[model samples]
Target: MTDCIVVGGGLIGMLSARMLHDQGLDVTLLDRQEPGQEASWAGGGILSPLYPWRFPDPVTHLASLTQAAFPSFADELLQETGEDPQWTQNGLLVLDPGQWDVAQAWARRWPDVQLEALDQPAVHGCEPALAEGFDQGVWMPRVAQVRNPRLMRALQHSLVRRGVDIRPRTPVSGFRVRSGRVTGVITEQGELLAERVVVAGGAWTGGLLLSLGAPPIEPVRGQMILFRGPPGLLSRMVLNDDQYIIPRRDGHVLAGSSLERVGFDKSITEAAAQTFREAAARLVPALADLPIEKHWAGLRPGSPQGIPYIGPHPEVEGLFVNAGHYRNGVVMSIGACRLLTDLIMGHAPICDPSPYRIDRADFSVRRSNAN
Candidate 1:
């Protein structure tokens, strides 16, 4: 029998499957569609949260652990799969001078987080393409980003090479529960028997868990636009207000995004595209002249207070959950995978798992049968 059956083949699910397999567990990963084509591929790949201080301790803690593990994780992927995710350490520039004090406080709270106040000239020196009027900003030197699509591809390749049973287009319809223990997963194709099952479904996690009596996970659609520009036009990722501009190594400048609670609709609207375009132009005036290469949207699995459910189900034996990461799925994947793996293997976790426990009061499922 498969030791573990991981539902949802996004970054979290794929990584969790790989981690479980590495620990000598026979693993099978199931996805509704092709793996890594959802929010995991659509993200901007920022290694840290947009405003680290704004989030609670749980979010920041997971992000910190993931950030520290990313370098080695990327290195290992490169060594194994010979595919580079283009992990770049160009840092992030926060243009909201109004939050300078708050950002400074965050830096003080975290000794490892390096935040520096930049004058107008310094801002220009870092990203000359930025529009004028940005007099001062916060520069986080430790911030980094990875190409999301490439990272997903590398993980998929690595997982396959590691002998993981990855099943794309396999939609999990329900769970086989005997007494209180989950015996296996009921997919569209057939029953997948396993000793343990993990629900890592992204935006669809809520629906998948509803029958099993779990918390509701909603889909928050985020629209993004890609601008093709000359290389070296924008060197660092720039965040102004809620929008951000990410510059890739290949002269593809990604400007996004609009957080709309529009369910699982991935359709891009003209208004959203225009909004992204304007935001990008504001960040870097030269981007106004650049051609928009693409426009798309992805559904982020949002949760209350932005904390993901990352532990075993309270009442369901042999069932675990790692979904509802919202926008930080890419950034928090490594730490989350580690935590879930440790829990499944009965090993002491590298970090405290209390905050991410599924049984937390705030994370309780709303369904009547959830208890």
Candidate 2:
């Protein structure tokens, strides 16, 4: 049997495959659609969670654990693939007055991150595009963003060049388990056996895991809108009312996003576009009058408390999972992939593995061990 078969080709899956392959293991990545076209491409690519303090410790811990590694990771991809992921260290500015106190308190807890409290004048000074009347804000100087599409392409290319087998349009329906071990997968083409399997299938992960009676790992759709503007139109990503405006180096700015739990649907709505436009304009008045260049939606793997389940499937010996990252999949990929690899290879994990285990819910797949 092959060493490992990774089911799902999103960022999480690809990164998982890449990390394992680097360990001298044979790895194959399979995806339902073209890899990286799903949530990985649709996300705004903010390196940090919006209002990071609002999330629980697990979410913040995973994110913070891998915070310092992102820059070199991106550079490694670009140098090896010759594709620019546009990893920019553009600071994150939060304009929500209500969260300032809590955010500042959270910042103090983590001294590695620098968060500055800005008054009304300082807020405008930081990002002059604002329309005014903003009294309080918090600025995270270390936050960065990557162009999603570019990053996806870079990662895809990097994996191919690194000798990882990435197969798109390969829908995995379920796993082939035997005697308390995952033997392989029930793929669309046919049965493909492997020594181990990692199911990182974002929104669709739950559906595939359901055959084995896994817990709910549903989809949360987030809608996004974009605006074309000059290079300096918006400097430093601005977050307000849970919506963020991210600027690309090439004079294009992206404003997003609304969270919706609408099942497997990826439909874009005008209501969401208007909502994003209004939010973006609140931070930059010109965005209100600027044309919305694009609108799209992607299904994030929604989980309880925005925490992803990483590690073994508990019952199935060789079956592992690293899905359900919700909105933080792109940013969380670093720590989650490393952590998943460590657990899979029976090595010391990069961090505590208790919080992300599938068995944390105390549920079984009914078909714990198979015939």
Candidate 3:
């Protein structure tokens, strides 16, 4: 029996397995498909939340705790796997007009988070690639981004190097429970016993645990469009409203995304691609001329108010969860993984785990039968 079995291979699950293994626990990670090719790879890899002040306190708190830790984490991965995640502090330019005051207030409240106000010329100065805008903007100079695909590759290699048994193409049917505690997981291959099981299955988490009664987690599809521009064509991450553009170290510029609660559909739509094109042109006129290189969509584990449930289930003694991070999965995984490990090890937590606890009376999951 493995010490812990992580039932997903995206950013959250892989990280959870690694954290568990670091504590001298035997960890096995199972995935239905290729690891990290889902939302973890499809995301723009922006290290900070988009218009973060709008989110709830829990969202902001977890995001805040993980922001500064990303660079070193990426570096550690590079050192271990020889793959550069391309962590760049290119900064984020928020052109959401009239929200500067709110952003400034948030900056003042969170001294660690640095935000600066910019006028029209200042905005132009910050991003010459942007179109002529007659308004104000908020600049987060400390915000960073990574090449998510590379980051995923590095993580896979790192996990393998540390002796994690990664079983891909192994679909999980359900969980096995006995005496109010999980004994193992029921997979297509066979039953694998574990001391603990963490359901970090992202959007599929709800469906996987439905028979076992999980929280309200559903698949929220988000579509993204990528543009291949010159290396210096776009220097920073430009955000105007919900649509934002991220430029990578290479010549590729990534623009995304839409929150469509259309089941587990991963289909690409021309309409959504056109919408991103319009957003790109609106933000940076130069993008209007460049053809879209790729368009794809991935499902996010949408939760209540975008706050991910990240603790043990109420009724299950040996079960835990670390999913439901709608758009902030990439930004919040560091803190979430650390918190999950802390809970599993029964160590002093990095932050108050109440906000993310899933066992609240109204949201508890109780299963009497041992399947």
In order, candidate lDDTs are 0.89, 0.87, 0.89
Can you write out model 2's per-residue Cα lDDT over 1-371, one digit (the tens) per residue? Answer: 68999999889999899999998889999999899999999999999988899898888888986677889999999899999988899899988877778887898888787889899899899988888798988989899999999988998998899888888888987789899898999877999989999999999887788767565678899999889888888898998888888999988899888889889899999888888887778788887777778899999999888999998886788889999899999778899999999998889989999989786343553335221
Off by over 4 Å in 2: 360-371
Among residues 3 or more apart in sequence or in different chains, the pairs in candidate 2 whose N, CA or C atoms overlap within 3 Å are none
For each candidate in turn, the TM-score is: 0.97, 0.96, 0.97
Per residue, candidate 1 scores C-alpha lDDT tens digits across 1-371 of 78999998889999999999999999999999999999999999999988888988888888888999899999899999999998899999999878889978877877778888899999888788788899998899889999999999999999999999989899988999999999999977889899999999999987898865666579999989999888888899999988999999989999988889987789999998898888888888889999999998999999877889888898889999998898899888888889999998999997899988876343353565455
Pairs that collide in candidate 3 are none
Q: Give the Å shift of residue 165 in candidate 2.
A: 1.3
lDDT of 3 by residue, 173-260 (tens): 9899999999889998999999899999999987788776777888989999999888889998988879999998777889888999
lDDT at 293 for candidate 3?
A: 86
Task: Specify the poorest-scoring 10-residue window by lDDT in model 1.
Answer: 360-369
Per-candidate total of colliding backbone pairs: 0, 0, 0
